[model samples]
Target: MPEIVYAYLDVNYWHPWKIFGSISSVKQLELCLPSSKEYPVGTVFHNLVYLMLCTCETEWLNLLLCLLRDSPKLKFLRFEQYHPIRPSEERPCWSEPSSVPECVVSSLETLEWVKYEGGEEEKEAVAFILRNARCLKKATISAASTDPVKKLEMLKELSFLSRCSGTCHLTFD
Candidate 1:
């Protein structure tokens, strides 16, 4: 609906796009959903500025990039991991986009990643954002691991990566 501006969806058993796709006017949205086999590319969130996704067992980076490519005005992007990844679940992977998304180059400003584990795919996704988000102003990453050594290694790895935005402040916690 054109009148709808904010929506929070917690989907347990179904693909989220099927429901939210019809509402393109939303400005803020939060979603907690299971991983989907297919990530469609046509849903255009024309007015979306803030988006938060719960990173469950799924192709999260694929979905994030797809949304970023479509939501040209997106400014705030957040990823939250609410549950520990199971050993049996397939590890997620990231494939570089042929072209950077418009939002990352022109609009995205803030990125908050909670429960960052320094996983291969997670590092790739975070690294890609930092390198490409020209307008990014602030990025806060909170490590999920409790081990001091692991956290230090994760921080060291990410801190050396170059950022596109000169003024962007990156904080590791």
Candidate 2:
């Protein structure tokens, strides 16, 4: 798998590292993941530049942070919901990382979130990236809600957050 440069894995398997460990050299990847308690600590994606994740899990922030920490050369990050999520009794959990990721501080340039619900966890994850991505050139957030009132509310809330990149353009889609 060292020769693999791109991979799209939509498997139901929850152990993402087992899949990722085989293809550490991939430059672009798209995958659907369920949250796992343990992160891929030793794996480093030295050549990865673009990543797209399906936000179908309730607790995906940990995995996202872990990937950001490891993908030092990542430039484009995107999140999209591949399937409708049923309401769950538990809300998604999110906790700020102790240190900012190298990708967000230096290499990341573009961000896009589709089917973005204005949930606390979602907002925090998006805000964290926007606040810290110093090289970010654009951020496009497409709200999941169709109602105008809800969209406006989300717009107002997200618009107020300070961005690390002075020239970054933010858009609602």
- Among these predictions, the greatest TM-score belongs to 2
> Candidate 1: TM-score?
0.93
lDDT of 1 by residue, 47-154 (tens): 999999878766677668777888999999999987666778887788999999999999999999999989899999999999999999999999999999999999
How displaced is residue 74 in candidate 2, in Å? Answer: 0.8
Clashing pairs in 1: none
Position 40, candidate 2: lDDT: 69
Q: How accurate is candidate 2 locally (lDDT)?
A: 0.88
Clashes of each: 0, 0
**Deviation (Å) of 20 in candidate 1:** 2.2
Q: Write the per-residue lDDT of candidate 2 for residues 1-173, one digit (tens) a residue.
A: 88998999776666666777898999998877776565668999999999998888765676788788899999999999897776863667789999999999999999999999888888898889989999999999999999999999999999998899998999996
lDDT on C-alpha atoms for all candidate structures: 0.87, 0.88
TM-score of every candidate: 0.93, 0.94
- How many collisions between residues are there in candidate 1? 0
| Residue-level lDDT for 120 in candidate 1 | 91
